[model samples]
Target: MRRWPRIAAWCVAALVLAGAALGSATVYFGWYDVSATGPHTVPVYALLDVASTRSVKLRSADIDVPDLDSPDRIRRGDALYRAQCAQCHGGPGQAPEPYALGLNPAPPPLVTSARERPAAEVFWIIRHGIKMTGMPAWQYRMTDEQIWDVVGYMRVLPTLSPQQYRDGAPSGGPASSLASASTSPSSSATATPPGDMRVGDMRVGDAKAGRAALQQYLCVTCHAIPGVPGARHYVGPSLDGMADRSRIAGVVPNSPDYMQRWLMDPQGIKPGTAMPALGLREQDARDIAAFLQTLSNFE
Candidate 1:
């Protein structure tokens, strides 16, 4: 019995070592096909599917599900889905765009996913997205309320016929509400005056818009940004007390133009810096710079 136990232990150790060696060799020698044109082998696909499914289930286990039967909420989700999701995932009447078709492990139709997965799992997937897949993390671009709306809409997606989908949510619905809400200033949050700050000759950079833009661009992921709700990570230095700093990235003078330039192309000014060039649009760079400038201190 003692001898058998020892043999079993040795066998397990050998197997672990062999698996490690195989993984290392595969990575180093480029033995795995990474091409999107090629589909994953049966075992590989099965393993990945199981892993992703389990991860979503575990993470979403504790999520509090809201009442998704509200007509307003469903309508909002319908509009949002048509605008943001339909192109990639398709809908009752629609096919995914040509580009979405080219993606490896192609984006699944939400109609099927809605029927199969729980609402919490679907919500988590939409908010956080999956790795090594084309699904984007919508948390960056959407609020929690918005994500929930999408989930609500998805629940009803399977029930809609092609004609009903085409007809869309009734007139004077979520679309109009969304438009009005966007134009109207928030009663709670203080509004930044339009063109309160300028970058170069252009009168731009609304602080309120800038703050939202910061969240949209995933800046909160790596840095501890004030006012933006996200993980308290410090992969990059905190943006607090940015206004007190005289230099941008310890290189250029901390002026609006220089700050915008840095936001647009971090690598261009400082070669080999860990900060990636996020391919920010000119207006987005200006907006980000404006938001950073507002960070006076850690308080």
Candidate 2:
């Protein structure tokens, strides 16, 4: 045992020395490429990505998310994103400006990637900012509500075309212009009453499709949804009695409209939640809602 301990200590010491020597040599010789034009090797980029995601997840896990999806909130977020984020991250219509393109490890396009992350993690990254990267801490510069508003807008960013995005902006022309553009099912079809068999207000969509939607969107990775076999993960709260619950995410009332909104942008319903916006279509959210409602009496 004594010899084993000594051997382990020597091995650890050797590893530390080797790491130190390698780091010093890299610094002294400038062997690692620091140029923006020269991308990090695939393995290096993967490692950094994993580290950043893990760190964000661990640090932001405790933040209490509030509702992030509302008409006003999304509008506000859209304005802010256009004004500030579009310069670097770009959007549907806007390409990243030259300044952003020159940045080392260039900022990823938010419209494509933001929905995949938890709202809390995105909030933390926005508020605290990442070191070494160009992202600055916004907590000092912007209010919590504003950061959340930006997050809310990001939820819908993937869905918006450049024209829709520009129109939604206060300076981008009249909001009425959107009427000509919106081809969504809810907007295109004749308005149906609350309990219509095709698309009810409270109980809409096919349950079987909802289950499939849950699986397709990887909801089981976090929630232990009833009826979905093998959906027992504990990252978020269980969905066993989601239908009976009066409130969704402790805020929005449990109704089909609210649930659809929740599914579209959970952070908008409750900011800083582990639930990321999955960017599902209106009909898809309705399908998921129908399935979730059936879980009220689940065993």
Candidate 3:
């Protein structure tokens, strides 16, 4: 009987070693397909989704988003959108690039996406970015002001009316579009950016109204603050005090219009950017900017 116990332990150990060898073979032999095109098996996908969500939450705990929206902020945001984001994500009433229409999660329109997540989550996704899924991180290429402008614009994109897409005026991409849009030779605290509607080069509407509309859109997902609840992993940035940031997405001016442009289609500004275009309408974008402008880091 005593000998039987020792024999059983050896048998179990042998089985475990065999299983390890099998698992290794599966990987080394390319038996498991890693292609995104290959839909995940139900169990595998479920497990991965759970793991992804958990990992994002754990990894993004330390990120921060500056006060993002303001009269100046939203305008710049609007410009950023026009110059960099408009094509892929579109604004107010337009649609995203044909690709956005077909993407897996079907890029939620920011107008509504903000409501779905917190501001910090939005910001983290914009800054640190995502892996695989074509969502590139912007921490390297962009400036802080640029990122925040996008954040502020996202807050109010859900309320815009619509913009008519023009041919060949401007496009997204850091080098080409940003160099032209980054600095506005003429702008004031309340004045808007020119030519680009999303950039807020021109005034959109009431600031207080914009702020209210932004909160209604739910711009407080992933952002951290002195008091907002929940962890910062819902997929966007928080907006407790977004108006004070000097930059957006680490680039661009922090104006309402600019916020509009960046929020409408951030992928254009930073190619492969994970920040999904919320398909914001023009009026919605403006409102979001207005709302963001109200947030300030008053000491």
The top-ranked prediction according to lDDT is 1
Residue-level lDDT of model 1, residues 189-294, one tens digit each, is 1222244334365557777767766644546545666655433223467878887899988999998788887775564566444454344556767777887778
**Cα shift from native, residue 52, model 1 (Å):** 1.5
Q: Each model's C-alpha lDDT? A: 0.70, 0.68, 0.56
Q: Local error of candidate 1 at 111, Å?
A: 0.7
Model 1 stretches astray by more than 4 angstroms: 1-8, 169-299
Each model's TM-score, in the order given? Answer: 0.54, 0.53, 0.44
Two-way lDDT contest, 2 vs 3, winner: 2
lDDT of 2 by residue, 144-208 (tens): 99999999888888787655555566644322322332334442222342444453333457878
State residue 137's C-alpha deviation in candidate 1, in Å: 1.5
RMSD vs true structure, all candidates: 18.4, 14.6, 17.6
Error of 2 at 37 (Å): 2.5
By TM-score, how accurate is candidate 2? 0.53
* Ranking according to lDDT, highest score first: 1, 2, 3
- Give the lDDT of residue 206 in candidate 2: 84
Evaluated against the true structure, the overall lDDT of model 3 is 0.56
